[model samples]
Target: MSVVLAGGGSAGHVTPLLALADCLRRRDPATRITVLGTAEGLEARLVPARGYELVQLPKVPMPRRPGPDLLRIGGRLREAVRAAGAALDAAEADVVVGFGGYVCPPAYLAARRRGTPIVIHEANPLPGLANRLGARLTPYVATTFPHTPLPHAVQTGVPLRHEISDLARADDAERLARRLLAREHFGLDLDRTTVLVTGGSLGAQRLNDTFGEAAPDLRAAGAQVLHVSGTGKQVEVRQSAGGAGDDVPPYVVVPYVDAMEQAYAAADLVVCRAGANTVCELATVGLPAAYVPLPVGNGEQRLNAEPVVAAGGGLLVDDADCTAGWVREVLVPLLQDAAALRAMGEAAARFVVPDADERLADLVEAAVEGRRVPS
Candidate 1:
């Protein structure tokens, strides 16, 4: 079987598509998988490196307001749709799976015109423009969150990395052993509970500033910090926490944690942004979180964190107010309470769907066969 996946722009879109692609290839090594993305999107680099074919399309981002850009978008979209059709023909895709992004809409349309099966996966609680449009074109729709409003949308949890999915389903004894081993290997203070803070690959300056400010309080509460303060922000963040004179600093700051699985294993609690993938990974790894949702556009970040918070697995913090005082007052106390942390971790582990990759692969197979998928 041949499959075409459409998505790219950020890791949020690309990662899930890759996860699904990996699942398909594993299930049947003979399966041909092609990724449709714009030359400008992240998929150009990621898809090829993953050993999948990448077909580039002209990016046609829809304008938000009335402007000359809006007028030019129609012509660009037509050309993109043509390009997508040509790619699909070249690959002879039996089914097109879309993980919503700018590249998806045109590809979805092209697949529909060719009478190829279409499957749409929306990772955000609030559906993006591309997936929203794609959902109308196909009844085979899946979402990471249950509340996403779409026609025939089924709750098939976000497909995740194999490492995270395995960790999620591991026995408690095994999980604990790995966590302890990871902490020791990282030279983390075993005496203090670990608090992992990250702002993803590029890092978030807001997290750096506030978390740094609250380092003293966190340490006083017997919690040690593992802060991935983005790339260039580390120097200033470390200096702000307290320079070289600071005695045995409680916070271990790094630009990035190359092995995120290890970081997740070492964490008792996490403090970070509430991206779709991040939320799923945190829940899968069974770690309680204090989510500071990005205070920007459509408020999707807050919505993404709501389910986990509701399940008693995490807490949501407003971006502007995620300051030292808030961390000291709320997060510090939670970290110090071992019982509460354990309960939260249990709740998180219970809430995740450990076989999301397999489950979504089933959906793709169903779509290809023109069978109705259970909602």
Candidate 2:
């Protein structure tokens, strides 16, 4: 079957699109997959890197307020829809799967015009404008969060990369072996209670500064830290007492980590932003986290972390409240409590639907075949 997937702007959208594409390909080697995305978005590189044909579309962002830009949106949308329809025709798409982003609106409209089957996967708890519009067009809607207000939405969870999904299913011994190997790879002590601090690819300055300031305190609490400060973002960490001594827990800081699966494997706990992808990934891998939601957008990040935190799988902290003092008082003690960490990790693993890629793929196939789409 020929399928065209749409999403962009960030990893949260593109990552799931790629995961679903990979799952579809694995299920049927002959399936043709085309990705519709913006030339300027992360999909420009990621989609092509994943060996899928990427059709670049003009980004048509909906103006939130009445302005001169809003006046021109109609014309811009028309142009984008025209381009999106042409791409759909070129691919001979039997179905259009949309993950919410600026690119999805045009793709959904174009697919509807062509009488193509539509399937949408929303990764955020709060639906974006693009996905909300897409939901009106199709009944086959899949959601990462159960509470997302989309009609006919199936709670399929977020589609994760195979490496992470595989990690989720690993046995205890195998997981421990992987943990040891990952720790060795990251130059971390195998026995240390390791905490990983990441703020996604671009890194959050607040996280870098606050976590960096708290590093010495974390080490004093007998925890090692692996801090990914994002590309070109420096985190100044002061070591405890003797700089590289065995008594001082290691506080390794790097700008970026290409192998995030390895980092995930090496971590005992994670301190990061609460993007839907991050939340789902942590839960799927049975890792406990201290989620600091980004204090912007439609407050979707906080919503994303809430269910996991409520399930006793994680902790939620507001961005403004995630100060160094908070980290010292809360995270340091949490790290020392090994039993609590293990229980939280177990809860996390039980809370997520780990096979979302396969489930969404099933929905797509059902949509194409005119069969009943599973909830």
Best by lDDT: 2
Q: lDDT of model 1 at residue 11?
A: 73
Best-matching candidate per TM-score: 2
lDDT of 1 by residue, 1-375 (tens): 999999998778888898899998999999999999878776888889889999988888964334687577788889999999999999999999999778887899999899999999989988877887888888899989888898898889999877777777788898888888888877786656899998876788889999877777776676788888887885333333444353443577888775588889889999999999999999988899999988888899999888889999989999998988998899888887999998998787778866777888999999998899965
- True-structure lDDT of candidate 2: 0.91
Each candidate's lDDT (Cα)? 0.85, 0.91
Model 2 C-alpha lDDT per residue in residues 105-129, reported as the tens digit of each score: 8999999999999999999988887
Q: Residue 274 error for model 2, in Å?
A: 0.6
lDDT of 1 at 140: 90
Clashing pairs in 2: none
